[model samples]
Target: MKVSSCLFNSLLLSAGVGLLAPLAQAGEASEEVKPAPLELDTAFVTATGGATDLKDAPASVSVITREEIERQPVYDLNTLLRRVPGVTGGFGPVGEQSKIKLRGLDDKYTLILVDGKRVGSSADLSYRRDLARQDLNWISPNMIERIEIVRGPMSSLYGSDAMGGVINIITRKVSRTWTGSASTHITVPKDSDRGQTTQYSANASGPLTESLGLRLGANVTRRAADEVEARRDAQGDFMYDDGAGGSKNQSVNALLDWQINEEQSLSFEAVHGVERSWASKKTFGDWGDTIGVSFGPSRLTRDSYILSHTGDWSFGTTKLDAYLNKYRNDLDMGKANSEEKIVEGSLNLPFELLVDQRLTLGGQWKREELTNTNTLGTVPVDYQGTPVSGSTLKGDYSAAFIEDELFLLDNLSLTLGNRFDHSDKYGNHNSPRAYVVYHPHPDWTVRGGVSKGFRAPSLKEGSAGAATESGGRGCGSLRPLGYLTGSCWMAGNPNLMPETSTNKEIGLSFDHDGWEAGLTYFHTDFTDKIEYGPLGQYQGRWWTMLENVDKARTRGWEGTARVPLGDSVTWRTNATYMLESRNLSTGEDLISSPKLSAFSALDWQINDRLSTELSAQHVGKQRGLGNDFVQSYTTYDLTANLALTKWLTLNGGVQNLMDKDLRDGSTNFYVPGRAFFAGATTYF
Candidate 1:
């Protein structure tokens, strides 16, 4: 199989060279082939942010285009994010609550930005699990023009929650002409007992004038009921049967842009979404409906709005930019809910000191708030007769940061940055970072950086309530023996410290002829890591707390190559390898991190009218907190697209074509197997 794969790759490269040879020769004869358009090779951002070629950026960054998203048949952001190296998606009971992790870091460390603005749930909540932030499912991938991921701390530029890195989601903007499109998809599950999913989406955008533009879009999705197999006990034996569940969700968004002259611009956007789910298990108690289990339905509704304005001015030879953003999110969950509001602003000045030399300075500020309530019903009484009730909590945070970039030469650059944050709950923290990039030749570029990042304690870590045990008097109790033996957990700590880390990284990129590839390595040493543990004498129940553990490091490498197979075909392949471990004072390997994983894909353009794709992914085995574990698995997917006409196109795909049953290590949830989907899109 390895030999065959190599041979196929060679053939593709040869065919690509052969196809491009004639074009190159013709261009040389007529002087038609000039340097590639700057826009095609560089990434563009708003005036307030720095813009440079992807290769010129002094960070490990990746950009996924709209065409790539379509080719991969991704239904949402989570699925598309899987393609990014050193990133992982967690599975949850409800699909809407899923979270993403980068470089083996938790979700709280990664900041998610939309159109360069922070827009999501606040971390000031009593339930850590419920503070997973924005639901990517609500954001329509169809409206995305491009996505840029910076794989390291950016708090100096973006402010809080940027410890692991930042993901900038750039939406499509109205250009010169008006255009609209619509698409629908129907997905069927491998299990005959499970129901199917149907998704529909539409978008339109246009310029009202040369300086004004508007865009509107919406998406709706319904997933059929699916069963989660029984969970395994300590001995890896199946326990009680977990029934099936289903979900329905819909969202809409609108955006307006006014280019007020050439140096100033203003934009406004609003989004609203609602999700509903029905499951067979109770959230907090033990009850029975069919097999003596209570069946309850869950519903979530969210409304969000953002307004931003930016200005640019030229002072002598220096370019100055300033911007402000206001964001709000309101969420309603059947029993409880929360509201979050944030105001942020920033200013940046970049100037060139001499030939091949440049400098940049920037600063930013942000404020956030979160309010939550616990609506879980009363706990059941045991033989010992214990009672518990739900509660509510609220929190707020504020932060500021500054950064600078200096270019020593055409081939070398250095960056230094710092951030300071003050939280009502976690007090204050200061973080600093430094970066360097060197290019020895036209085809080789090397980069290295080190930074100190931190995450403030969440509201959940300060004031969340605890649950009591029944002294082992109930046979169906889920609590441990120690808990049932007379121990009960208390509330959280009011003086918890922030989680801090020293992150270090090095990377290299090469692009020559028809080949391009990149490799990056990173290590993070964490202090005051937060974990769910017993607080002092509170033996049984778990409390969200912090500890100063030893070094925890995640090292990874990613490589990708794209070779055109003749004029109408291209073969692109990428692979990722990651090794994550922790050196405790006791020297023990950390559990739950997937030691090795990989994904690959091949694209074949049969003709201008049709194309086919095949991809495969592999996940390694993982050890849990105790003796329990998860096994390794591999899955395959196939897809095809046919252009029925210039205005109409058909697309279909089958995921898990091998029908493999798999479960994630982080959330311990089962993934659907052998799902098939078909859709048709129309362009006008």
Candidate 2:
């Protein structure tokens, strides 16, 4: 979790109950259908970021159902996202440092959410990640209902990290019928030296009363490390891989809902999660010195609390949500430590503005604070070079927005939205979005939109000493997400401005006779791109400061398809190809970014008690995080499920079937060859 000291100023935690839009009617599935297949024609709430039909939204959206989650050979959120077209995850410089890039955009550009509110820190520059991201590892897969993704600018709807897109992890809901399930899995690498991973979880949901319901879930996971023989150093001595630094995480969550009335509802939720990892863990010893040098043992803890109320009465529906989140990241090196806290609230109202049109109005207020200290850290000094102590920093943000969806015809509609945001340090700015969706036929549709997005300067960038903060291998450039690794630091730029970009997209989809396909093309122009260093003679290196000195353009194509093979087999695939990701300011190729990525799966059902699936993925080369000459890799996976009885089922899979050597030089992330796992699920 610790990336850099900037993580204290840049990283943040966000929590909210989320603004849930009202639904027109209840949806019921036929019990006779038994176990139905994945639905591609279903509705989703993340495209427009509200309760809207997927076919009616004017943005490119994809959904991963609970069923799919149960079937995929993945453990974390970033890995799950790679299966989505136009998205890819960095292999890593550090195991936990891996991030998602959408349409060749950096992780900082994408936003992640839990329920309806944001997850992880809003900003984390580095220094052991005082405010590290609320990683998916915190949530139990058994507690999820579904995951929705929007692959395009959505700043007008959700502000900030929406420039690239949004990934919303929706938790399971309270069920009307008493229901619960328990599941566990174990994974073993082809090479025993690589160690193993074991995970388990249980969840339950049902009605406590005619108008009251509750849901509870919990999970525990542990990963063993490895002691592989790495390339030798110049001395000809074999180097040791840091894979020995293993990790453990656990979480407990609860949700209580009260249907106060047919038109009103109240809910309260709580989530507690903690994680521990060590860089010095050794394979031969209980706790080895695998870390070698620098960074040391580390741990991060996070907690979230939320309360929400929604009502649908009179002429419109209204929603109010409040949340508080706290995080602590600690590194034994220099006794580095970072603690962050965030409190937020928002109100939303959706009302009919015309006979066939609806308007949504909303406002939000939030505050972020961070405190961090390291014995080896530098404080801003006086003009006389006297070091001053500054271990705490904070900032406030406020915003108001409006969205109008107007129907021009029964089959044609336009969505227009605008938002204005004010930050104590960066001042105020406005963002706008426009989209038109037209359905020429029930089976065919077209959609397109233009939008603007921006990212506010972090408190570290606006308040740190101009020259006192320094360290890291990437000190020479404004690194993208995960910029700092070693001792890298930068001189603060108080006058720094927010980063900005404009995006345009066009897309079409077709569905008929169990055939579904979609294609989208996008182009984005970025300005005021933020990074460190504008080459200078100062200290014989680039001046490290947050400056608006970069510009660039990117274009790409994304496509997805699903076809039913007979009545028992199905095939699905998604792919993305980026044509360019250039740095106009430096006229150089960009850093780690997705170029060509594709995912395909085939599912077969053998009778009513047995089923199997095969999947493959191919990822093209990408620039190293800060180095030159990145690499490309491909992997395959196989999985199977068998119903032992009405309430019990067996599941298993083999990941990295080809055992392809997967690793990114810039990021410490690596694939330890092929692995196999098996587990069982039981219902009650």
Candidate 3:
């Protein structure tokens, strides 16, 4: 796809207005006194592997501050991400089944991290594949210091699973003085039968000794399931379709940081979380007739242990990290589990040869194991042609990367990086990236980058022993093949290639006296996309298998603005407009991704003790399976906060204030109606 002149002209016009409006206001404020130089936030660390200014970061980055997290109630990460540009949720009943998407790509393409450590997804081990939600909410919101979202490919530094983008959640650090807070919140929907939620959380951080500090946090949440009207089946039995699912979540995390010396530090951390989810679903026959109903709870648990060390030497800085993660899911059929062990290290050196530069070197080793009874137990054999008896699928990979940032001129900088990865199953691959940042004026910045990234096939997608069965309607083919009268099998293939993409992005922004605005354009050429389809007939049963036979392209524009309405109020907004997102072979739109989405919020500090916020989200029409398209909709929320005393705070809100009905006839997506919530926090 090509960029049109009309779209380019519009962007130029919008950016010109945004850049001039702030300067015009500043010119009229003062003539004798000049404003201070523009200073941007520099605590962002995800995009560049270390603390870097948001304006200087080579990639498109955004940060969610702790203040934003506290302004309104949020239990899950997806709800919070709705405010960010270039993000969307997978199509499914709300809850454990919905996944997070970036840049019109699937959830598996995005990487989730905690304090620079990986958080493995449960879907990788389950037979349902990408249908499961990512394990993103393991850490309570109260324990988070900030979240960094980097859009576009990042494989040059982070390796695989970063082809789409990366989200890094930074947790609170240990404080010198002992401090703690406890809070509880309850939300009730207009409909009494469903959508009720309750949560309790607490956190504390303090000094444990002269050189050591400790931090701990825990939370519990439970939500009642949404009730869907039942229907009578052919056999006169009551059956239920998909509805918003209910979930119970509990988590605890602890960290101990030791100041080995003024120049060095050591840290150890542990996190454990459990989730139970239940939903009523109807089973269908080959002819799309309701056959039976299934209702039960599935349990998922995760545990992580991490050890890290950092040293600041006279010449440079060095860091090392090692972590172990385990995830397990228990269902009626059986239990599926996975484990990951990783060791990583990095070194930074600042020196001058021909020009001033900073160099970074890093390497990582990872091993993964998965045991799924649901997919592996169907047959009496294994992938290695060995008899099945407690057999487990395992894979390992190693990677090395290098990056250099060069100060070419007083107002210009360039960054070049490359990464080499060797996988046990897919052999070797290389990713490279180049970026440049320029400052024409102190208040204006221009940045652009182009990079290549790849996503290796998951263990479940590469295991020949893994298989799933569905009725005729679920079968896939390369051509116009007639539907089968019986069930067919979709098996995994061991000889699939990795998916790759070339990502390019350019952005321009202006900032002055807290008036900020920016615009970015991004495009990606994706090839060798892995998908499931028919691979001819096998033993007369008909078969579908994973293959690399698809190509796609995605392009879009993103814009953001923040303006102070007055001394007591502020308005913020961000929006995304899609130019193209299509599967080249079939010329169809990507599923569940909106063409135009936007979020806006207004915050008012009425007084020293009271504050309120009004927010709205608009999602544009989206294409679905075949020729179907989901209609567009908008929702609004209102929330307020009151500081009762020095040690007490109260908060409440009305979500979906407009009472928008998100249901369309199909059960692909769901969102609850108007709801009220209240909470209180006590500090010590």
True-structure RMSD, every candidate? 8.5, 9.2, 9.7
- Top-scoring candidate (lDDT): 3
Instruction: Give the per-residue lDDT of model 1 (tens digit) for 1-684.
Output: 012444434433432332333333433323222211112323644211367666667667778787667654455576667667776554322322145667767667788777776656433322234323344566676778788887767665655677788887887766457877888776666555455677888988888988988989998987655443345545654443333466677889888888887788787777887766655331212333332121112456667777777677774122222222222223243234555566656566666666333334444444433334432222232112344344445566666666556778878877776777776666777777788878899888898888877776654455433232222222122243233344333334445577777778888878877667777778777777655443433232422223343456666676666677677666666565665555454354555455665667777765555567888766566554344456767778887766556676667767788887544323343456676666667776
lDDT of 3 by residue, 132-181 (tens): 66768898888887889999999999999999899999887787788878
- Candidate 3 TM-score, C-alpha based: 0.88
Which ranges of candidate 3 are over 4 A from the true structure? Answer: 1-42, 90-97, 230-242, 281-297, 380-391, 471-473, 476-479, 625-627, 664-668
How high is each candidate's TM-score?
Answer: 0.80, 0.85, 0.88
Give the Å shift of residue 175 in candidate 1.
Answer: 3.1
Write model 2 residue lDDT over 284-342, tens digit each, in one string.
Answer: 33333344322213566778888888887776777787887776666454333333333
Could you tell me which 10 consecutive residues in candidate 2 have the lowest summed lDDT? 13-22
Model 2 Cα displacement at 321 (Å)? 0.5
CA lDDT scores, all candidates in order: 0.59, 0.68, 0.78
Q: What is the Å distance of residue 563 in model 3 from its true position? A: 1.5
Candidate 1 deviant stretches above 4 angstroms = 1-49, 90-98, 122-134, 227-244, 280-297, 316-335, 354-365, 375-396, 464-481, 484-490, 536-551, 563-569, 583-592, 624-626, 662-669
